[model samples]
Target: MKIKKAFRRVGMFSLFVAAFLVTITSISNVSFADVRDWVDYEPMRITNTVTNTVTESKFRQSSLEKKELNYLEQKKMYISSDEIEGPKTLEEAANINQYPKSQVVATGYTAGVESTGKSPGHPEYGITYSGVQVKRDLYSTIAADLDVYPIGTILFIPDYGYGVVADKGSAITGNKIDLFFNTVEDVYAQWGKKELDVHLIELGDGTLTEKELKQLNETDSLQVFRQQITES
Candidate 1:
């Protein structure tokens, strides 16, 4: 009788564990692709499992029922857009920038052997250290020392656009950072290497989630941050 009761309890516990795991899987896999269909709407941001940026999209403002939208706008949840057209000089970058600006050695990287010491044919060739797939998207992917920059640091370069720290390079340490380029030639002829002042939009908490973004919205300049990235 005792053994039978024990078996039944164990079975129930196993079922509970399975259900929890399934629920977690579903939540982490949520994608924003469906949001592309929305028309006649306002801008909003969402979170991904890895690195996330405050991306703007057109959606029916009424969809939020005025809660999230109101909070976002009333609280001024975006960064400053004054960085658009980029700062012609470090002085200009620091002057118009809303965040704490600093200087760092910046270089361009490719997903090839010359930059990553990995062949292009490799399966993980373009994957960032933080598991983000590197792409030429609205914002650029940046590589730096994870110890120094964490995983989601956003740096706005003068005369350049915004770059998010999603990868790490073995040689990148201290205050040095690397910007991603689609091709090696672009790295050499275009970006190469230079020292520039960068504005620290927000320092990621070594984790990606909606919580971190919300925290930034509360205290940082997220309104202009969106315009700088999208418009510039």
Candidate 2:
């Protein structure tokens, strides 16, 4: 009986070792590319190219992040109305050559009725004025003045990576541009308005209508699709 027990123990130990080896082997077999899609979420820090003169990347203001917002109401209550300015800038609207690069006022937004007046599941929920679907992370989109940037103008914003002007907004004319976010909360938190550096890579062809040229040229799809989202 003792001999039998000892043999059973040896067999079980062997099985455990075999299983451990298999797991390590499987893990080693996983190619880096297989997991890079997820690992890339962290903002990249690199120098040389003209994304940000500061040489930093902002993690795409995630649209997938979900956090409790009950605390936000209390935060909002304390905000002095004196600090709140209307969405559009006080500067007079003028066309400027945004080609190659320029500074633009950047604001973040989400794809909700509050921003686009179209709820999720609406026919045009995540669609841009250019009619392309807007995506987050690396595929993030932007809204700018089409007259300046046009329908397919591509831009590289500091911290933010390359984003195509896929939509436009009324208040987005001139040097002002609106960025897409997952939630209105992110708009206020991650990217409240600011004048940021922009590197214009290429200008899109003027659509059926027109294109005079300059800053905040790309149109945002949400703004293009929803004419009724902004508040007075």
TM-score of 2: 0.45
Residue 203 shift from truth in candidate 1, angstroms? 0.5
TM-score for each predicted model, relative to the true structure: 0.49, 0.45
Q: Score candidate 1 by lDDT.
A: 0.67
Candidate 1 — worst ten consecutive residues by lDDT sum? 64-73
Winner by lDDT? 1
Indicate the residue-level lDDT of 183 in model 2: 79
Q: How well is each residue in 88-205 modelled by candidate 2, as lDDT tens digits?
A: 3211111123445788888887789987889988998987787766655432578999888887776766545456677888788998888887778767866688897787877778
Model 1 ranges off by over 4 Å: 1-96, 208-232
